[model samples]
Structures are given as structure tokens and as C-alpha cells.
Target chain A: MSFINYAAREINVKIVYYGPGLCGKTTNLQYIYERSNPQQKGRLISLATETDRTLFFDFLPLDLGTVRGFKTRFHLYTVPGQVFYDASRKLILKGVDGVVFVADSQEARMDANVESLRNLEDNLRENGFELKAIPYVLQFNKRDLPTAVSVDEMYRLLNYKGEPTYEAIAPQGMGVFETLKAVAKQVLYELRRK
Target chain B: MDAGLVMYEEEFDRITSILNRLRVESSANIVFLVDKNGQQIAGAGEIDRVDTTSLASLTAGNVAATDGLAKLIGEKEFSILFHEGKKDNIHISIVGQRLILVVIFDERSSLGLVRLRVRKAAAEIERVLTQMEAKAKEVGAMEAASPFAEITDEDIDALFSE
Candidate 1:
């Protein structure tokens, strides 16, 4: 649902980062928080558990310049990646405009990635946002780690056909903005089509 | 128009500088200066994926309902609402006269920081808005008409046409 404010000619869009535990979902947000210009970004909120799994969510509000005369702001959020936090993840998915599935690239985490993807689909469906209907971008994170699966193999296992995908090392800031830019651009495109 | 409504370059910088200062001072996930309807006027932190449109509508509905309920109970309108969910917690504060400030956080953040930062930011935001309202008065009543008020049933129908 679009909430248009007459006061400020700005449109707000919500995008979520989701995946299995240790997929760098939170790290992706941290990197953006660190690198973005001060005036263009707002608070970076992170929620984690005893073992450091994202407990609730991580949130970041960004001002991505503007399109036409309307200001474009992207609200980035991340759901807890651990399996036990399934309910939390679903709640976070409510009213999402875009999704970034941050899959852990390690071969051992392949099953986790697949299951997490399924979880995302299930949650979106429950929220009345179909997986294919909403703009989604895939991100294979932890590319810097040893024993990481090849991008080709990761894609074969997790790809949603034709969806934009990116290879990233979030902690080091590789491909973070590229992925954000892609998803944000797609979100704006979807709005224009509206 | 009060000089307050129109933010100067220095005022903008002041808010930005406050963001960097409060990012470390508090562990808040997202701090927003929004309207009562949930339209964010300004904010600091990671808020990339949260839905403000739905949030604003929901908040407005919540405020209205609560206010109505309070009136029924012979009480005043509510000035705040806190929604605690499994994944995120929202603290909504009515600031200035018409603006709303929301602080969204998770388990990893602190309430104290959220409060302190909001305290400073809210005062500044209220000051600017007070100036804006005054300026708006000077702009004449023609521009004061709400776009929403002008939206007709036909416009609503068109919105749902697809």
C-alpha cells in the first residue's frame, strides 16, 4: 500500500534482508550504514541474541536522493536468520516492497539457504505478497570465506529464475550498494508502473 | 512563515550531526521524525525495509481509535502507543502538535539511548514545525487545502481500478 504524504513530496519504500543464520544479512546493513553519507542516512539498529543471531531485526533508513521531484527513501530491514526466529521473520515481512535474500555461500550452509528461501516464500504468501509478484534480489554473501560454494552451484541450488543476483562480501563492503541499488531501482520501477 | 519552518543549511547540518552522535550514544535501530499519520519527516539509522506507508496508516488508525476509546472512557486522547512484536518493537510519540516520532528497535538496542536521542531531536523538530505552521498561515488558506480532502470518490475508484 502506498502512503502518499502531501506535506513532503516523498515516497517511502520498505525492503527486507533475509536468509539463514550467518548469511551476512546484518553485515550488509552495517556496511551501508558505515559508508553512506551522513546526511543521506539515519540510525542503524541491530538486534541479536546470546549467540549473536539477529534476535528481532536490524533497521536502517536511507535517503537515496530522489526521482523527479519526490524524495526517495529506502527503509532497510533484516530479520533474524536463525530457524527458531521464524515467527519473528514473518512479522518483519509484513508490507515489504522488496526483498534481498542473503544466502550463505559456504557449501555446508547450502541446506540452510534452501530452507530459508522456502521460509521466505511461505511468509510472503501468508502476507498476500507472492514471491514472484514482489521485486526480489538474491545476494550470495561470505564470498571471502574459505570452503564457500561456487556462485554457479549456489545459483543452481537457490536461484529464482530471472531475478537479479549479486556476489557479495558484506563485511568488507563488496557488492553491498550494488545489491541495494538494484533492489531500490526495481522498487521504484514497480511504483512508477503503479 | 516563521523563520523556523524553513530549515537553513546550518539547521540541516545540525540534525545530521546529531545522527552521527546518537548512533553510538544509543543502540536504536531506527529513529524517525514522522507525522501523526506515520509520514517520516526525518530519521537516522538503518530503516531500509520497514513499511512506513502501512505503518503510518496503521498508526493513524490506532491513534484515532484510541482517542475515541479514551473519550468514551472520559479520558484524553492517547499521545503514544508501543507495539511489541517478536521481531521489532515500535515506540510512537506525538511530538510538536501534529508530528509523530517513532523509535523502532530490536533486542540489541537500548531504550535509554532511544529516549535521550528522541528528546533532543523532538525539541528541534518541534521548533522547526512551529515555524512552519506560522509560515503556512502567511501562505494564505488556498494552499492549506489538503490533497486528501480534494481526492474524490472517483479518485478512490481509480486507485482501486487495477
Candidate 2:
């Protein structure tokens, strides 16, 4: 959800990065955190297990300077993508304003991608939100892999809403900003509509 | 539930004052208000030394996790949570089921004092929150004329123009 403070002249919005395990959800956030100006970003927090897998969520808060008169802040979160972490995933989606579904582009991971998308829809529903009603985008990550499936096929399987989709190699920072910009734009536009 | 929360000047002042009062009454090191979505609304007391934003986000996450535990145990919700540390303690409570009230105290203050003060502050905060909600609903009509309404694609693109 977005929080607008007239007294503070600030607008804070929440955006969630969601996908299956090893699909680069945390990597996407890490890239953004490394590239962001230190003055414009908060600490990158990850509630992870000893193995470094996200156990709960990864959080990054970014300040996008001023938009109009209000300082725009975006809080980015990534849910634990392991299937057994459904409860944690649902909790993370509670007040989400936008979603970035990072799908593994390899041909072998297509089923995992589809399952994760369905899980996302179900989790969002439990939070009283629908995929079609919220600002959402898809990122086909791991595009540099030799076995990466075509973007068209990934979309045909996963993009039921036909939301904007990006091809990314998150470890290399490819298409990272582009995906963020697209979802952030949609969120801002949605706020104006509201 | 509303998809957004807007804090007007009047309600902001009221909340800040309540937090400030609670800080003094409870002898707290700091007190801040956070929404369920982890946005820090207002803070008072010695806040400069702490990172309010990170604390706010983590506080919300903690509350949400507790809520999940409550559900599993066949409970509606746990309205309050307290964490006792060696030197510092944190008292977290939900106000109006929409906002979180957090009080950080050290050895100088007792839990009983903080709890009592929080109960009083929660009531006052609840009243102000009710008013703020109503005001937000009324402002919905004015949103059509908001600066955001006039924002163009170019303006959005310009944010990342660097």
C-alpha cells in the first residue's frame, strides 16, 4: 500500500519482488541496492537462513528524490520463494502496492515459473488483492543461460494479464532498472488513478 | 481495507503530540507510529540516534508474523507485544487494527509504566485515526485535482532520467 503524508510531504509505496526459488528475486534487489546512491537508499535487510536463502523476506527502501512536491519512496521486498514458505509469502503480500514476478527463463524451469505465478495469484487473493487490479510486471531472468526459453513462450505460459514483461540477466544487472521503472511507473499511475 | 493511507496536517500534529506525550509519560527513549504497511508516520523523543525507517519496517514484519501465529493458535489477533532486552525494551501494540504504536525504553522506565501510558495513548491515537480516515474519504473527491493527477508519462520517465 502507498502512504501519503501531507504534513511530511512524502509518499511511500511498497513493491514486492516474487518468484520461485533460485529465480533471482533476491539478486534483483541486491543489484538495485548496489547501484543506488547511498544517500537515496536505506539498508538492505534480508531475513535469511544460514544457507543464505531468504527465509522470510528481503527489504530495500529507495528514495526517488521528489516527484512534484512530495518525496517519493519505494520499499522493495522479496518473498521466500521456497514452496514450503507459503505462510511467509502471504505475510509479505499483505500490503503490497506493486509486484515484480521474476521468472527463471530456462526451459527446465518453466513449470516452476508457472507454479510460482499461480501461487502468487493465490497469495494475493488471500490478501484481498487480485493480480488484474494491482500494478504488476513480469521479468524473465537468467536470459543469458543457453537453455533459456523464448520470451514469447514464457509470456504465453505466465502472462495471463499481459502485463509488461522484461528479459533480464539479474546477476549482470541487465534489464534490472528497466523492469523496476516499468513497475514503478505503473504503481505511480495507479496512485494517480486512485 | 483501503489501498492507501493519507495523513493530513491536523491528524499528523495530533499523532505526533500523542507520541511526544507518551514518550514523556512513559520515560521512553523513543516512540514512533507506524502503519501496518511499515511506513513511519511520526516519531518523538531521542530519534536521531536510531534508524526509524528500518525499525518501522521490521516492526511491521514482526507484528505480521505474530498475527500469523495467532491465527494458527485459533486466536483473532494479539493486540500487543513486548520484548524485554538487557538494557532496552520495546513495547508494540496495535491501534485501531490499522496502525502500530512502538515505545522504546531503557533501564530508567518500567514495563508497567510504559504499558499504562501506551493504553492511554492508544485510545487517543485511535480517535485521531478515526478522524483521519474520515478526512481521507472526503479528500478522495479532491484527488482528481491532485498534482498526481496532472503527472504525465514524461514526468515519471524523468525520475529515472539520470
Candidate 3:
């Protein structure tokens, strides 16, 4: 949900990074947390398990300067990607304004990627949002892996909506900001449309 | 998943006044209002020591988890939650299904007093929010004329130049 505070001249939008297990959702958030100026970001909170896997979700709030006299802030969140955490994933998508689907590009994880995407669609539907109508982007992550699938193959299978897609090596920070920038822009354009 | 929140200056002022009054009357250390979506709307009292943003987000998560548990047990919802600590206590209550009100208090106040004051405050807050929602719907038609309507792709690209 986007919260527009006329009194404070601020706009807050919630964006979620969603995908299957070990798909680099948290890596994308960590990259943004490290790169953002201290004054423009809040503490990155990770509720994870002992093995460093996300238990519930990861949250990072970023203040991305101003637009049209309103200070724009985006609360970035990543859902727990393991199959057992589907309940937690649904909760995290409760009030999202936009979404970034971080698909694991490795050929071995293709089925997991497709399952996760289907889960995303079902969860958004339950929350009264249609995936095709919402502001969304796709990130084919783990592009640096030797066994990764080609971008064309990944897009052919995952880009059902033909949304803007990026090739990402999230750990190396490549395409991290690009993915964020694309979704954030769509969110702003969505606001203007409303 | 859009919660569709729109706050105006006048509505915010009114909500804050009610919150401030509740804080004084209940003698709570901090009192704040947050949307069910985890966005902090307005707050009053001594909040400098607390990170209200994180508090709001975690509180929402707690409520959501509890709601799931409630369903598992054949209940529709649990509207209020209380957690007690040695030095402080946290009380959270839902307001009109869209917002949550939280009060953090120490030994200076009693739960009974805080609950009493919050009951009155939540009703007033709910009233104000209803009015705001109605006004927003009325103004929705004119939103196409917003200053942001003219934003271009170049404008978005400039945001990342730095």
C-alpha cells in the first residue's frame, strides 16, 4: 500500500522481493542496505533461522529523495523463500505496492522458480490483487553461476506478463540497483495514474 | 494489496491531538497509531527513545501472526494483545480493522487506566479516518490532474544519476 501524508509531504510505498529458496532475495536487500547512504536508510532487520535462511522476512526502508515536492520512501521487504514458509510469505505480501520477482536462473532450480511464481500469483490473488495489473519487475538472478540458464530461456518461461526483466548477479551487486530503480519508477508512475 | 491510505493536513492534526490527549490522560510513556499495513501514521508522547517505525512494523507482524493462530483455533480474529515486561508494558488494539493503536507504559501508569483512555481515543481516531477515506474517494476523480501526472521517463532516470 502507498501512504501519502500531505501533512508531512511524504509518500511511503511498500515493495516486496519474492522468489524461491536461495534465490538471492536477501542478497538484493543487503546490497541496497550497504550502498544506501546512512541518512537515507533505516536499520536492515532480518528475522532469519540459525542456518542464515530467512525465517520470516527481511525489511529495509529507503528514502529515495523527493518527487513533486513529496519525499519518497520505499520500504523494501523480502519474503521467506523456503516452501515451508508459504504462510509467512502470504503475510509479507499483505500491503505491497509493487513486487520484484527474483527468479533463480540456474537450470537446476527452474522448477522451483516456476512453483514460486505460481505461488506468488495465488498469494496476490488471495490478497485481492492481480499480478498482471500491479507494478512489477523480474530479476533473473545468479547469472554468474556456471550452470545458469540463458536469459532468453528464463524470460520465455517466467516472463508471462512481459514485464521489464534484468539479469542479476546479486552478490556482486550487478543489476541490483537497476531492478530496484525499475520497480520504484513503475510504482511512482502508478501513483500518478491513480 | 493496496490499503489505500490518504492523509490530509487537517485530518492528521486532529488525529495527533487525540493521541496527545490520550498520552497525557493515561500517563503512558509513548502512544502511536499505525496502519494495519505497518505504516506509522501519527504518534505522541515521549517517542525519541523508541524507533516507532520498527515498532510499528513488528507490531503489525505480531498481530498478523496472532490472527493466523486465531484462525487455526476456529476464531475470526484477536483484536487486542498485551505483553508485559519488568520495566515496561506494551498494549496493542485494533481500530476499525484498518489501524492499530499501541501504548507503551512503565510503572507510572496502570493497564486499567491506559485501556480506558485508549478506548475513547480509538473511537475518535476511527471517526476521523472514516471521514478522510470518504474525502479521498470524493477527490479521486481529480487525481489525474496531480502535478506528478507530467512525470517523464527522463525524470525517473534522473533519480538514479547520483
Q: Considering every candidate listed, which one attains the maximal TM-score?
A: 2
Candidate No. with top DockQ? 2
Tens digit of lDDT per residue, candidate 3, span A94-182?
Answer: 98999999999899999999999999999999888899999999999999999999998898899968899999999899999999999
Worst 10 residues of 3 chain B by lDDT: B140-149
The sequence of per-residue lDDT tens digits that candidate 3 reaches over residues B22-127 is: 9999999899999877888999988889877788888888888888888889998898899999999999999988899999999999999999999999999999
Better of 1 and 3 by lDDT: 3
Relative to the unseen true structure, what is the C-alpha lDDT of residue A38 in candidate 1, on a scale of 0 to 100? Answer: 88
The reply for model 1, stretches above 4 Å from the true place, is B1-162
Superposed model 2: Cα runs more than 4 Å off = B142-146
Q: State which docking tier applies to candidate 3.
A: medium
Model 3 DockQ vs. reference: 0.62
lDDT of each: 0.71, 0.92, 0.90
Query: How well does each candidate reproduce the native contacts, as fnat?
Result: 0.01, 0.64, 0.56
What is the Å distance of residue A150 in model 3 from its true position? 1.3
What value does DockQ give for candidate 2? 0.71
Candidate 1: Cα lDDT at A174: 91
Which is the winner by lDDT between candidate 2 and candidate 3? 2
* Local lDDT at A10 for model 3: 85
